[model samples]
Target: MYCRNCGNEVSEKAIMCVACGTPPLAGNRYCPNCKAETSPDAGICIRCGVGLINTSNHSEFDWLTTLLLCLFLGTFGIHRFYTKSIGIGIVQLLTLGGCGLWTLIDFIMIVVGNFRDGNGKVVVNKQRA
Candidate 1:
C-alpha cells in the first residue's frame, strides 16, 4: 500500500503515514494502489483506475454522546439531532418521544450498531480499532 498523503510506501495495516504523520488514506493527492500523482477531487486513479478510499478514520458520530442524549433528552430527540437526522428528531419530538417506545428502541439500535451517522458509516470503538 501507499500513503495517499505523500505517495510513500506504507504497510497495509498502518493507519497513519510514517512519512507525513497523516492518516495513510486521508489525502487524495496520490493513488493508494499505484502511487501515481492524482487530482484531489479525482474519483478514480488515472493509472490504476481503482476507486480511492478515504483513509481518515474519524467518526462523525459519538457513541457515548448519542447514548447520553437518548437516555436524558430522548423525549426531544436530541440524539437524533446530534446525528444530523433532524427530520427524525422532529418526528420523535412531535410524537411525545415516540410514546417513549421509540426512544428505547433507538437506544438499543445504537448499542448494536444498527444506527448509522449522516455519512452512513458504522460507529466503532476507537480504542479497539
Candidate 2:
C-alpha cells in the first residue's frame, strides 16, 4: 500500500504513515493501491487503473420515497416497509391502529435520517441537492 498523505510506501493495514505522521488513507494526494500521484478530483488511479475510494462525510438517505410513503400510506406502515422495517410494519398492520402515532413519529425521523434499516445501515439517497 501507499501513504496517501506523502505518497510513501506503507503497510497495507497501516493506520498511520510513519514518514509523514498522517493517516495512510486520509488524503487524496496519492493512490493507496499504486503509490502514484493522482489528481485531487480523480476517481481512478491513472498508474494502477484502480478506483479510489471517496470517503465523503455524508449519510445516505432516501428522501423522496420516504416522504411519499409517509404522506400517502404512513397509517399502514408502508413507510416502514420502504425503510426495510418489515417487522415493525407487520406489527403496525396487525395492531390495526396502535402504531399510528409511532408510524407518524417514524416518518419525521426518516426524513431526518434518524431511522435506519434493519441492518442498521443508513439508506443512501442519491438525489442531488
Q: Every model's Cα RMSD, please?
A: 4.6, 11.8
Model 1 quality (TM-score):
0.61
The TM-score values for the models, in the order shown, are 0.61, 0.47
- lDDT (10s digit) by residue, model 2, range 90-129: 8877764255787677767766656666545554454642
Error of 2 at 126 (Å): 4.6
- Report the lDDT tens digits of candidate 1 across residue range 41-82: 677898989997453433457788888888999888988888
Task: List candidate 2 segments past 4 Å from native.
Answer: 1-61, 96-99, 124-129
Worst 10 residues of 1 by lDDT: 52-61
lDDT for model 1, please.
Answer: 0.80
Residue-level lDDT for 78 in candidate 1: 89
